[model samples]
Target chain A: MKQSGTIVEKQYFTYGAAPDRLQLESGAVLGPVTIAYETFGTLNRDRDNVILIAHAFSGDSHVAGHYPTDREGDKPGWWDFMVGPGKGIDTDKYFVICPNILGSCMGSTGPKSINPETQKPYGLDFPMMTIGDMVTTQKALLDHLGISELRAVVGGSVGGMQVLEWCVRFPEMIRSAVPIATTMRHSALAIAFNEIARQSIMADPKWNNGDYYGGDFPRMGLAVARMVGHVTYLSDEAMRRKFGRRLQDKEAFSFGFFDGDFQVESYLRYQGSKFVDRFDANSLLYITKAADYFDVVDRVTASGPLKGGDLQKVKYLVISYSSDWLYPTYQAKELVQALKRTGQDVSFCEIEADCGHDAFLIPDERLTTLVKGFIDGVG
Target chain B: MKQSGTIVEKQYFTYGAAPDRLQLESGAVLGPVTIAYETFGTLNRDRDNVILIAHAFSGDSHVAGHYPTDREGDKPGWWDFMVGPGKGIDTDKYFVICPNILGSCMGSTGPKSINPETQKPYGLDFPMMTIGDMVTTQKALLDHLGISELRAVVGGSVGGMQVLEWCVRFPEMIRSAVPIATTMRHSALAIAFNEIARQSIMADPKWNNGDYYGGDFPRMGLAVARMVGHVTYLSDEAMRRKFGRRLQDKEAFSFGFFDGDFQVESYLRYQGSKFVDRFDANSLLYITKAADYFDVVDRVTASGPLKGGDLQKVKYLVISYSSDWLYPTYQAKELVQALKRTGQDVSFCEIEADCGHDAFLIPDERLTTLVKGFIDGVG
Candidate 1:
């Protein structure tokens, strides 16, 4: 479905009935799962030119363009700079599909989704999800679109986790894969940060044990979580360049109780406050947990690597940013090494950028060229 | 006032009567200030052997030795590993005095202290404090004890900030100074973490605008804040070695919502919960704010650098840890550079340790040797 506007309209695809429920890795079952997706460009008659784009933690299916009524400041899809007619993804030559993974709040099944049995928000009762579960659900959507073979699958961060999961679970389904700024398993440091974020949210009394629906939401907790997350998403150099020790509209130190004296503090406070308006606290909890549970080694070895078909022919492009301490270059190297162990064709690149893990989404000529070159070479 | 026990007994020194109030940096007057301190060893006849030890953010006047009736697991003192008769600080050679800084909850004039005007907890009414203010209060305690000059003033982290302040404020009073793992000014990244910690505390309903003294304290928020602080104190390598991806008492993934599946999460939770028991939430807010407000450059250039006495004569030893991202080695280098600019005698070292910002408090042979050598050289 196409809309007559600069923004591509989001389309929904549902599958699985009550008895044919999607069995979660946690043994819980979810049914009538709906996946929200947006497509750019036209699919070839054979549907062989289809490319699936998975989004990161806070991103959705809206990867490019803007809605018809979008105002001047309204953000176009996050990757609007790269996914266009002749941009990196090159909408003119390839059919690009972006899906908001399950367990996210953006028009997808998640903790915010209502439970059919209780008719209330799933909240904490939402079945625990993993990156494999997200990939499985997305695969069902591809099957529904009559795309048996995908030209490419690409993602970064948690989305990148899904991309890796796709390669391991259904290696024969995709011809090429790009997983950027992701890790096979969460590091102790990463888990520590995530746990602190979770603690920040759960500590807020407004949370009321995650049953704050139809009541005051845990905005303070969620905002704190976002503030913490935002700090990790940027490098020390990036923060120094952007905010530094600059004061926040004050001439010298306030020395007052709790004023935002530093520009960085003010910037972080703004980021935290702004995030509460758009993101759900429960969704943050669930999605972060999903990303934490992702371990490609466990999935690949669950039924023996040899039993997972002839995956040697799959082409892999792994990319990382030098300043991304959240998912540093070492993580991408680990993935490339793992892929090599399986005799897969893998190309790795570590871009020198101070933007940190968010570099994958940031517009950079090098990134655009590398992505375009990798996709073109897939032919 | 020597006590006959392994642990030095804490003594209180009160200053600033009703009319002769201590004017704070914020133009607020605070009177009847009390400082808690503990001294080890004996001061020579001329009082030329006194080595003042300033404590870090959460530390107190207790520097070394076990209390007579203390159990085995009871920590002797925050820096018990270093300050002892034969240890790094070398109580046998130098008289050691550790004072709980002003604005600290441990028997010092702080937010938790009663306001003589209202005969109630000061809470948020406590006048905003700075590292300079803390050093000034410490100097008052020394004056009351008839100690005119210190052999050396040493500390790490926030304590280090105070050490820098002493060098700039009362350079003639100290013969040597050692500021470890500290910055001349708070970095944006450091401020961001501190702001998040403050936010975590303030977001809790129990915080009650800092008036929870008579009611339930903001334990949850304080705990979350502690959790966040605890993460910054250790390096990624340290965390990997200590916790890694180990599970918390489970064979496999719990897949349950909000469960501390990872050992690191469990450790952080424990750290957070234990912190609230011994720490005052309001004091935490106030002290962290004090830390954020500390900028040595501002103090150094308040008037003319020449106006401050001959700070050039002070022997300086600035130390930093290699993996301390919170207060990285570069920060120590900056402090040394600032000292050198003023023509001060300075020695600098960046110890290679994976312990992160808390490396100073940890027992390391290199740190001990350097501290001993630096102190001995000051004579």
Candidate 2:
């Protein structure tokens, strides 16, 4: 799936045992995992400046630059602003690697992938994945790169969950970590959003028990789910500011159920429709489930009963956006509070950005400065 | 349709010629309409004290008391708190009339009703309806009751739109109007919410173009739609306050997508599934479309061509909730501004309530007191 692109390289790698031996939390193991990754900048002499970037829902390994084999009208990848040289993540200073998560459709092993045993798509039968499972696979990738330690780990939203997971699951692997606009645990409200999206997919008759590979697929359900998730990604103020009472194309109502009467309707429809062409509904289900079930506190708490995790050994910089209602500032505060309780060396900054949860993906001078300064201080 | 054992007597009247024909803004006449109304208190000789209560989405004519005829576990009525004796509307002083709107399945001539011309349910073939059409039918119902004027017309959310429509459609018919937790128009953001809900319904394969009457009837779509609407009804703060990150039953992740991993998920699913048993998907589509097309600002700014409608002359009491992101206080302010600009007698009230868009249905003493005092002052 490598596309020759300017400025960044998109690539893939194999890690661990074959698909039949990948291990599970419940003492089950099945493997042969493939990872789709995009790399920016060059690794240092000691290969110690590596920074892992995890993609969120609907995200892929194409974190920055134009996909080498670009098509007209292709979307600039979700985090393109942050990964380019001289940008927030600064590919010029850091070796950045963004990998499509285990349960995604961006060249990763998901429901859309073929089942070696049956010679058909895995579909619903694909083993349910957890955030820990995703991190464990990333560890395998790091080992393949001969990287014994990472300078830092950074992510936002579900990606932020992965950053936190890295801090817990592989504390020694990361010197500093930044989790932006993310929750410590998936809130009931958060899980509700994912469940509704999953229900929307399964409800589609064309989903065909996740076996609609050669047909129309459940594009409508997938679109609707994306629309729902899109609403969460935006702040109410941002929505109102952008398209309050704005008409679509006409001055008056058509008085019929058709294209759109309001600008937001047209915007959402476009979002939903465009999403289906590049996304798999089953991957949406699997990835959201993975994020919903992710909890760093619970995992660490279980190991040493929530008392023995020494966070002082781990330097943390938590970033939250003021207008991000999906994962509000208080959730970040909660994370800070729990980390403090665990006696961690933690610093928190809530940036007053109005871009909502997507702020983490955009280029904010303040954020860029803070991140660069924090990384320098940790080094 | 009138088998009732409640505080008030049920009245059924055939108003339009077609089962669901209510006149639209295009000078189109809709007929054969049926209205189910519950009138509380006497009409009085002059019928000046009649107050019309427009129910919100999924509401019925039963405004108060448990109907002996109602099935077990069903609600008595949505607005029982505001319409009973000494309540906000004050049944002791005002003759309150709550009517099931024309395009609803609750004893009104909707898609579920038999089209006398074809002797089968109208289903998708039913003429499309607008908020104006609903108001027109309600006016006819009032005419059948021999009420020459109403002291007030009151509603919340979608019902609030009806209240505004009553004033705009028949300014002379209503002396004062209270529209709560609603806007002068469905904002682009609001329309987006409704659009996703409608898309959720239409996407369900079992919908089969709204002809699924006897067999499987898009329950999944309806449920998903309701779930989408439910999220909008509650504020982020409310959800955080109510559910937080609380797990449903087990303290740990189930690692499977069975059900009820979180409390909010269970609550939303419950809200959705419970709604499917009584509501019609076609009605959902029609009512949402009506809401999306409604805009009082269009009436006030006819020269500017906002929506192009005749602005009715009536006093307005526009009420909004502080925590209502769905229809925030800013929207209500827009309504008041439009009415003020049009030289209409409009008073605005911003009620401080923790409840989101559903605040009007809940008994906030401040809101109820403000409403009662305003109604009395207008009278």
* Interface RMSD of the candidates, in order: 1.1, 1.8
Which regions of candidate 1 are displaced past 4 Å?
A1-5, A298-311, B1-5, B298-311
How far does residue A92 in candidate 2 sit from its true spot (Å)? 3.2
lDDT of 1 by residue, A1-379 (tens): 3343356788999877698999988889998789999999999988888888999998899999876667777778998888888999989989999998898889989888888889999888888888889999998998888888888899889888888888877877889998889898899999999989988999888887788878889999999999999999998888888888899998988776467889998898999999998888998888888887788875543423565554446798999999999988887887777777767788999999987878887889999999899998896
TM-score for all models, in order of appearance: 0.96, 0.91
For model 1 the local lDDT of residue A314 reads 77
For every prediction, compared with the true complex, DockQ reads: 0.82, 0.59
- In candidate 1, residue A112 scores what lDDT? 81
Write one digit per residue (lDDT tens) for candidate 2, span B1-379: 4334345656788865754555567555556778888888766777788999998877888887666566656666677767767887788888988999878989888888887778888888777787777888888887777887888998888899898777766776778889889877776567778998998998888888889887889999999999988888887777878887677887876666666677888889899999999899999998888887777777654422232445455777888888998888988888888778766788888887666888777767888788889888884
lDDT of 1: 0.86
Q: When only chain A is evaluated, what TM-score does every model earn? A: 0.95, 0.93
How well is each residue in A256-296 modelled by candidate 2, as lDDT tens digits? 66667778888888999999998999889888988877777
